[model samples]
Structures are given as structure tokens and as C-alpha cells.
Target: MTTTAVDPAKCRRCHRALTSAKSIATGYGPGCAAKIRGAAKTADLTDFKPAQIAKATELIEQGGILRTRRPNLYTAVSGDGNTTYLVARQACTCPAGIKNRACYHRAALTILAAA
Candidate 1:
């Protein structure tokens, strides 16, 4: 399952208590954030639209996409930063996805897999 409202004092990935102010602010520990960034560096955005690619990159860089406890499942923050959606291998639980349309969250998933 994906965690939507993450606690500021815990790591998003491992749910471990976070002591560092930076980690708490970002919702991820230093190591986990580094891993996400490293993965994003290698993601291929050739097939997606420029806007999608840019958004996907931004999600990774800003810690908007978070790995859930389940394999192949993730939680992505909405563009307005007001909501989080569950993303799986084949589908995402976002509005665009609900209508069977594409969304940047899927592209973010591809980026996350590199980690």
C-alpha cells in the first residue's frame, strides 16, 4: 500500500524516524533521497513529451514521488501539491489515469525503477 500523508519525522521509504532537519522537511532520509536522484539521472525520457519528461524530472528532484512498502507501488504528489495518488506498474490512481489517459506519474515510475 502507498502512504499518502507521510509523517514529517519519518523516512518515506523505510518509515524510519528521521533526526535530520533536511530529511524531515523532504519526507525522505538522505540516503533514500540520494538513491532517487541517482536513479533519475539514468532515466530515459526520449519517448515521452517534453513537458512530461520535465515534470517527471521535477518530481524526482523535489521528492514528489515516493516508494511505497509494496513492490512496484508508489505514491506521487499531485501538481498542486494538495494530494497524493497511488501508482502501480500498469496504472495510477490519478484523475488522468482514472479516465484511462496518460500522466507524468507513470513517467516518474519509469524513473524510479532505475533505483
Candidate 2:
């Protein structure tokens, strides 16, 4: 049987070099992968709109988000130069968040934090 090649990149979650082929292919160590799976299982996505999910995914892909020192805090900057804070299980500083509704910043943070 043929075998997959291992990559020289580090794990996405732990920032350590991946030695296993499965880890290299998945971009996460086995432990980290399990943790991410658990987090994904516990994530609540029912409140997010399809547009918001898409926007969040785009923001993440474009490197427009960052996690803060606080476990539940994140900062997301939009292309329009607007900076918003996403407080975990609390609220975001964006307009939609201020209106007591789910926002893209929060959604993006949720996705990032889970991973």
C-alpha cells in the first residue's frame, strides 16, 4: 500500500512540529484534534445566519481576527477599518452585538476559538 507524505509544518493548535502523517494532513496533533472536535460538538450555531457564517469564514481566512489574553475575548478588524471585540458568552462591541443580536465578529471568534 502507498503511504501519505508528512509535512514540515507545525500544528495549528499547539504550534509544534507535526511528526505523524495524519497530524500533518489534518494540521493538528491527535490531542488537539480531539479537543477541536469536542469544542465543535459543543458550539452553538443556531443563532447565526448564513450570511453571518459566510462573513465570519471570510474574515478568518483573510486574517482579520485575533484572540485576546482573556479566554473569551477576541478582536476582529473589518476591511472598513472598524474594530470590534467579541466577548465569549457575553457580547460583542459591534452594532449587531449592541442590538442584542448575534454578530459576525462573535461568529468568527467562535469558529476560531473552537479550532
Best model per lDDT: 1
Tens-place lDDT digits, model 1, residues 16-80: 89998778777778888888777666677555676887798788667888777898889999999
Each model's TM-score?
A: 0.64, 0.59
lDDT of each: 0.80, 0.70
RMSD of each: 6.8, 7.9
Off by over 4 Å in 1: 1-8, 60-63, 66-71, 82-84, 98-101
Q: How many clashes in each structure?
A: 0, 0
Lowest lDDT block of 10, candidate 2: 81-90
Which lDDT tens digits does candidate 2 get at residues 21-88?
Answer: 77877666888767755654466767888788778766755556666777766777864866555555
